[model samples]
Target: MDRYLNHHLKISGVSQQLFADAAVTAIQQGSGGLLRRANHLARGALIAAAHEKNQIVSAEHVRIASTELI
Candidate 1:
């Protein structure tokens, strides 16, 4: 999972440790489905990053995206 998270973090440009850790935990603990939620979060983060014109995906973006999924 660490390898997966690291790869996504690099691709997502998420430099914040807190956001990265939260993302990892979200995927690890996803209730309905792990892979599905991970993909959702990753895709959402990428969208959020693009929308915000941010090089790094932020915790706020993750939070927003997760809430949208919920």
Candidate 2:
């Protein structure tokens, strides 16, 4: 998970533990349709954080992104 986040998401400056916890929470709170939806939300969160000039994707970003999703 960490590797995918680092390599695929191109994110940095966040502790692996923090990111993992946020991801787990996002997945758990998701609609339970598919893992892909959770993953998409997570990735969108990272992008949102980046857009906000955040060095790392925090729980706040995930929460915001989750809300923006359908």
* Reference-based TM-score of each model: 0.57, 0.57
Model 1 deviation from the true structure expressed as Cα RMSD, one decimal place: 4.3
lDDT tens digits, residues 1-70, model 1? Answer: 4466667667778654434565555545552457667678766875886798876555566666777787
TM-score of the candidate numbered 1?
Answer: 0.57
lDDT of 2: 0.65
Scored against the true structure, residue 53 in model 2 reaches a CA lDDT of 90
lDDT by residue for model 2 (1-70), tens: 4454455444556544435566656545663646577678777787888799976667787778788887
Clashing pairs in 2: none
lDDT values of the candidates? 0.63, 0.65
Tell me, by TM-score, which candidate is best: 1
